[model samples]
Every structure is written in structure tokens, then in C-alpha cells.
Target: MAKITAAEVNKLRKSTGAGMMDCKNALVEADGDFDKAVEILRKKGQKVAAKRADRESSEGAVIAKVNDSNAKGVIVSLNCETDFVAKNEKFVELANDIAELALNCNSKEELLDAELNGLKVSEKLIEQTGVIGEKIEIGDFRTLEAPFVGSYIHAGNKIATLVGLSAQVEGAETAAKDVAMQAAAMNPVALDEAGVDQETIDKEIEIAKDQLRAEGKPEEMLENIAKGKLKRFFKDNTLVNQDFIKDSKQSVAQYVKSVNKDLTIVGFERVALS
Candidate 1:
């Protein structure tokens, strides 16, 4: 058997981010050939990741990445069964690596199929499942691309949001980030009141009237009561109608208008616990 040296083990550790013992084992198993050792470790890790495929992954992390120039960004939710595994360094690194992969991917399906450090994402997930001993899965993957985009991850990995701005301003990044934060907190259904469909509004109005009637409100006051309730519905569901998180004195739309009239929110996305 070829002798494996400390230098070779350190090199493998640096190259693969595997533990010292894992690197040493691979080196010894590969007869001290560096490249062969890496391959062996990768294959072994993959097998390990695959063994835990069916374990439920209910807890994990949401990771986001932006280009160095801040032109594009992506967010992804990588889930695992236990909070302990979710907080593991390996899992967090995997989540970040996947989010970076998402920046180049146009769709979730494409992202899932894309290669991560030479392995397909699904393969990596399976490998991670084996290592983490949980059924880890990629819950959500979203990317935002524009002249400029910003992202925010709320407390823990419970929520993630991304926002794209049309025109750049002095504090545009912060503003866009605040918008994403609002989306995370408010859980808005539409960008603005106009974006809410008539059918949905009508249904909500009907539900409101039914509840009010159940309470024995006077028939003549039904229209006024329903209108009032509809306004509340808009406040709850519309992005523009939501109170700005930084300052609740104004709605998000009003806050944006105060920032720049030309700044239109081209698009936004939010992912949270289902």
C-alpha cells in the first residue's frame, strides 16, 4: 500500500471540504493518489447522501445570493427533517451552493437538474440526505434578474423575498430590499389593488356579507359594511396597500412614491412556511 502523507490529507481536505478523517481515509483507500482520493470521497459521499433519501426534511435554511456587481440574485429553500441537521454547516453550505446555482437557472425544474460542483442537484440532495440522515429536498427555488435586484431573508429560514426595481436610485438597493422584507412580512397576494381579480374581490365581499348577516346586522347597512370589509381585505392582501414595514404611517405604495416616482416595482417573489 502506498503511504499517505499529512500534506496529501490536508490538500484533499482543502479541495473537498471533507473532514480530516474522511480525507485521510480516502487518501489511504486511493493508495495516496490525490485525484483518485478525491474521486473516491465524492463517490462515497454521494452514496452516503443517497442512503437517507426517504427521511423527511421538514426544517432547513433559505439561502440567497447576488452577483458581485449586484445585477442579479436568487433565493432557495433547502429543507431537512430536523432543525439540528438544518443548522449543520454542511447543510448551510449546500443551501448557499444551490442558491448560487439558481442564479443561472431560469426555472425550478432547470435548477433541480443543474449540476452542483459536478453533481446534479438531485444527486447532491440525495447524497446530503444520506449524510444528514434526513429526507432533504429542495422546497422552493426563485431567481430575480434585472438591471438591479435585491433580496432579504427574514428571521431564521422561515421567509425569503426578492424584488426587482425598474429604475436605480441612491438607496435603491435598500428600498428594493425593504420591499422584499414587506412581502415577507405582509404575505401580499398581488402587487397592487388593481392586480386583485374581480372574482376574488367579489367572493371576499360575499363572504364578508354572509358573516355580517350571521351577526344580525341590519339589511340596509349590509352594503356599507361589505365595502368597509373589502377595504380591509385589500389592506391585507395587496402589496401596495400594505403598511410599509420601516414606517407604518404610510402604505407601501405611498412609501415607494415618496422615494421616486419613476421607480416601479417590476416584480417580486416571496416564499414562506406553507
Candidate 2:
């Protein structure tokens, strides 16, 4: 067996972006060979990750990253079995790192396969399971690259929202962010009343009619009353129909129209714990 020195471990750590202890262990296992140590750590991390695959990961952090130009962004949910492990500094760091990669990569599969400090991301997560002492998994990875994109993460680190806007305004980024925050808070299901599915509307109308009948309302007026209630339901659940959080006097659609006639919300994503 070859001796592994502190300098060799430090060199490997610098090369791999791995923890000090991990680098040292890899160096020992590789008999002081730098290239061989890298391979050893990569394989070990994967094996460790697999061993903890069945562990439940209910708690974790949701992280989002936007480019300096605000043209591209990524959101990711990294999960762990315990809230205690989810709150760990290392776990948060890993989440952020994966989010950054998600922004650069096109798909979740690509992001998972991407290299992280030399080892594949999935392998790194597995490797982390050994150190973190919990089952860690990448829950969700979503990337949005649009003309205008913004994101918001609620205070608890559990909820995250991303919004994409299409507009011809100079400071659209700020507006988009505000909209994203609204989505995070209010959780609108669709961009407008028209965007809500007809089936859902029909179901809601049926429910309203049932409630009205239970209250002994006149059967003749039930359909009319249900229709009226459906309008309010659309107002509550649609992004454009809902009142703007900043100003209750006007709906979000009206607010957007006031700012720019051409401004339109393309899409949005909201993520929270199950």
C-alpha cells in the first residue's frame, strides 16, 4: 500500500471540489494516485447514494437562480428525509449548486447526468447521503429560458414560484418578479378566465348548484345563481382575473393593461411541499 500525504489530499480536494475528509479517504483508497482517487470517489459516492435510495425525503429546500441579464432561470427542489438534514448548510449548498446546473441544462435528465465537481450529480447526491446521514434526492428541476423571467422563494424555503412574461416594456423584469411573488402567495391556477378548463368550470357549477339546493334555494334560479358563482370562482383562481395584490381596486389583467397594452403573462410555475 502506498502512503497518502496531506498535500495529495489537498490537491485532490482542490481538483474535485469535494470535502476535505472525502478527498483524504479517496486519496487513501487510491494509494495516493490523483486520477485514481477521482475515480474512487465517484464510484463510492454512487454506491453510497444507492444504498440510501429507499429513505423517505419529505423535507428539503427549493432554490432558484436567475442569470445576471435575467433572461434565464432555474428552480429546483432538493429533498431529504428529515427537516433537520434539510436545514443543514451543506444540503442547502448542494441544492443551490444543482439549481445552477439546471439553469444551464435543458432537461432534468441532462441536469442529473451533468458533472458536479467531477462526479455526476446523481452520484454526488448519493455520496452526500453518506455524509449527511439521510436519503437525499433531487425532487424537481425546472428551467425557464424566456424573453423575460422572474422567480420568488417564500420565507420558509419550502415554496418557490417562477413566472414568464411577454412584454414590450423597458423594466419588465420588476413587473415579472411582482407577478411571480403574487403567484407564490395566491397560487393562481390559470392566466385568465378563458384559460381555466371548461370541465373544471362545469364541475364548479355543479358543486355550487348542489350547495344552493342544500340551502333550500328556488330550483328555478339555481342555474342562474350557479353561473354567477362561477364568475367569482374564475376571479379568485385566474391570475388576470384576480385583484392585484399591490392594489385591490383593479384586477391583475386590468393592471397589466394599464401598464402596457401588449404585456401578457405567458406562463408560471409554483412548487410547494406535498
RMSD of each: 3.1, 2.7
Question: Among all windows of ten consecutive residues in candidate 1, which has the lowest summed lDDT?
Answer: 125-134
Identify the leading candidate in terms of lDDT: 2
TM-score to native of every candidate shown: 0.82, 0.85
Give per-residue CA lDDT, model 1, range 1-274, as digits (tens): 9988888888877666677898898888888888898778767766765666566666889877778766788888998778887778877888888888888888888988999877788767765553444677888777777767888888777688888887778778888888988998889988877888999999998998899999999888988899999999999788878888899999887787788877777777787755
| Cα error, candidate 1, residue 187 (Å) | 1.8
Off by over 4 Å in 1: 33-36, 68-71, 113-116, 197-203, 218-224
Kindly report which residue pairs in candidate 1 clash with one another.
49-126, 49-127, 49-130, 55-135, 57-80, 57-81, 58-80, 58-81
- Candidate 1 local lDDT, residue 250: 93
